[model samples]
Target: MESSAETELGRRVASFRELGGLSLRALAAAAGVSSSFLSQLENGHTNASVASLRKIAAALGVTPAQLLDDTSVHTRGVLRAADRPSLPLEGAEKYVLSLPPLRNLEVYAGRFEPGGSTGSEAYVHGNSQELFLVTSGEVVFQLAEERYTMRADDSIEFLSSVPHRVLNTSDAPASVVWINSPPTPNESPHAPA
Candidate 1:
C-alpha cells in the first residue's frame, strides 16, 4: 500500500509540472526518464526512489524537499511572501529578488532602491515567458525597442526572449513581482565562462 506521504509527494510533483506547463514527455526528456515511468510515478502506481526523485527535482528546478513537502496550499501552491528565497542579480545595485524554489513556475518579488537597475545592458532569456507587476513606486521597463513606464498596480507580460531591463525611476524604493514559465539558467554572475 502506498503511504499517504508518498501519494502526496506524487501529487505535488504532478501539480508542479502542470504549473510549469510541462508535459510528461517534456519532463521525462529533461530528467532522462521514460515517459511511462513518469506517468506511473505521477499516478502513485510506483514507488520513486531518492535518486529518481533527485533527477526529477533537478529537471524541475526545485529541491527534492519542495517536491516532497505537503506544506503548500494544495489549491494554488501558495508561497507566503516571507517564505521565498532572495536571489541577487549580477551588476544590479540596491536590488534583491525572492526567487521561490521552482517546483512550479518561477515567481519572484523584486525590490529596487532608488537609482537601482537590473543591469547596465538588457538581456534575453530564450526559454521562458515573463510577467512583471509593479507593486509600489515606479519602474521603467525597456523591452526591445520600446520603453514603458509602469506605476503601482500595473502589470505586463511578454516573451522573456526579447531583450529587457528594469530601472527604478523613483526616488523611493520600487517593488515588483516577476513570474516566469519554465526556469531560467542557474548561472552565477561570478562564474567563469
Candidate 2:
C-alpha cells in the first residue's frame, strides 16, 4: 500500500511536470526512469528510491528537498527547530525556518565550522535583499571588494545583486539567522551565500 507521503509526492511530481509542460515519456527520459515506472509513480501505485527521486528532481530543475517541501501549509504556522528542513551548502549546514516557495520571505539558520565557506565563487541574486544576524562566533562576509567581519549579535543588510560569499573565520563554530525577503526561486535553495 502507498503511504500518504508517497501519494502526496506523486501528486506534486505530476503537478510540477505538468506545469513544466513535460509529457510522461519526456520526463521519464529526462529523469532516466522507465516510462512505465514513472507512470506508476505518478499514479501513486509505486514509490521511488532516493536516488531515482533525486534524478527526477534534478530533471525538474529543483532539489530533492524542494520536491519534498510541503507547500500546502502556506497559511501561518510555526516550525520548531527539530522539525525544520535542512540542506547542505558549501561547507555549512542550512536549516530552513520558513515555509518556502512563497513570495514573502525566507528564514534560514546557517551553521559553519572554521574554514567553512558558503561557496568558492561569488554569485548574484538580482533585485533581492538579505539581512543576517550573527548568533555565535564570527563570520566573514565578502561583498565585491569589501569584506565585513560579523561577530556574535551583529546584524547586517545588503543588496543581493552585489556578488558575495560567507566564510567562517573563528576557531569555534559559527551560526547566523538569515532573512531574505522576496525570495528568489530561480536559484537552487540548497546553495549557500
Candidate 3:
C-alpha cells in the first residue's frame, strides 16, 4: 500500500506499543489488525483509521486520547477523585489510590452494596499485610476460621495470606477503605514482559 502524508502518528504508535510490551503479532491480534498492516503503520508506510486507533488503545489498556494527545505531562503525587481509577470486585467497587507504582503499599476505598458479599470463595494474598476500615453500615468479616460482625467505624488489620472475605449484612450500602503493603499478586504488572 502507498504511504500516507507525513505524520508523527507512526512514532507514537511504535512508542506506545513498545511501552505496552507487545510484539507485532500480539498487538495486531489484540487490535484486530493484520500483522502486515500494523507493520505498515509502525514503519510510517500507512495511516490508521479512528476505529483502529481506538482498538489499539483498548488492547493496550489505555484511552485513545492518551495515544493521540501530545500533552502527556501531568502532575503526580496528589490525586483527585475524578482521576482516581476504580476496580470492580465481586460485590463491591474499589477506588484505587494514586500511589507511585513502585511503592510497596496499595490503598483502596471499597463500596459494598446491600447483601453484597466478596464472593463465596475465600482468597489469599501471599504474605502481604492488609488493613480494612468500615466507613459505614455493617459487615461480616471472616479471616481464616474466625468471623467478626463489624459496624461503622470498625476496622481490622491482619495478614492477607489468610483466607478471608467480607459480606455486607446490612440493608444499606457499606463502605471500607483498604490498605495493603507489597500489593497482591494479581495486582502486580504482567511479569515484566
Candidate 4:
C-alpha cells in the first residue's frame, strides 16, 4: 500500500502539472525524468526523492513548499518560522523563506554541518541571478574554477547558470541565505555539460 505522504505528493504533482496546462510527457521532459517514471510517480506507485521533487517544482514554476503544502494560507504575506518548510539533505539542510506565487524572486536559508557540502559536484540551474550571504560561521563557495571563503556577513552575487557548490569545513555549523531572481528552473545537478 502506498503511504499517505506518497499519495499526497503524487496528487500535488499531478495537480500542478494540470494547472500549468502541461502534458505528462511535456512535464517529464522538462523535469528530465522518463515519462514512465513520471507516470508511476503520479499514480503513487513509486516515491520520488527530494531532488526529483525539486526538479518537478522547478518545471512547474513553483517552490517545492508549494507542492508539499495542502493550502496557500501561509503564502499570504508572511510565513512563520515554525511553519517554514525544510529539506534536510545529507549533511546539509535548507529552509524556504519565500512564499508561493513567487514572481521573479525566491529566498532560502541553508544550514551546513561541519564537513558538510552541497555535493562533491557543482551544479547549474536556470537563468536567474543569485545572491548568497553568510549569516553565521563560515562557508567556502566554489563558483566554476574560482573558490572563495566567506565569513559571517559576507555575500556574493552571480549568475545561477554558473556551476557552484558550498562547503563548510569548520567544526561548527554554518548558516547562509540565498536570494535568486527569476526563480531557478529544472536543471539537475548531474545535467550533461
- TM-score of each predicted structure versus truth: 0.57, 0.57, 0.55, 0.57
TM-score of candidate 2 to 2 decimals? 0.57
Candidate order (lDDT)? 4, 2, 3, 1
lDDT (tens digit, per residue) of candidate 1 on 103-157: 4355566777888777778887655778889988898988898999999999989
Root-mean-square deviation per candidate: 5.7, 8.4, 7.7, 11.1
Per-residue lDDT over 53-111 for candidate 4, one digit per residue giving the tens place of the 0 to 100 score: 89988998778888888674223335678777777655888788765435556788889
Q: Model 1: number of clashes?
A: 0
lDDT per residue as tens, model 2, 79-135: 778877788766788887765334467678999888887778777775577887899
Cα distance off (Å), candidate 2, residue 40: 34
Model 3 accuracy (lDDT, Cα): 0.72
Native-structure RMSD, model 1:
5.7
On lDDT, the leading prediction is 4
Residue range 88-152, candidate 3, lDDT tens digits: 66677777773433245667777889877777777776677888888888888889999999888
User: Which residue pairs show backbone clashes in model 4?
Assistant: 104-182
For model 4, the run of ten residues with the poorest summed lDDT = 184-193
Q: Candidate 3, which segments miss by more than 4 Å at Cα?
A: 1-75, 189-193
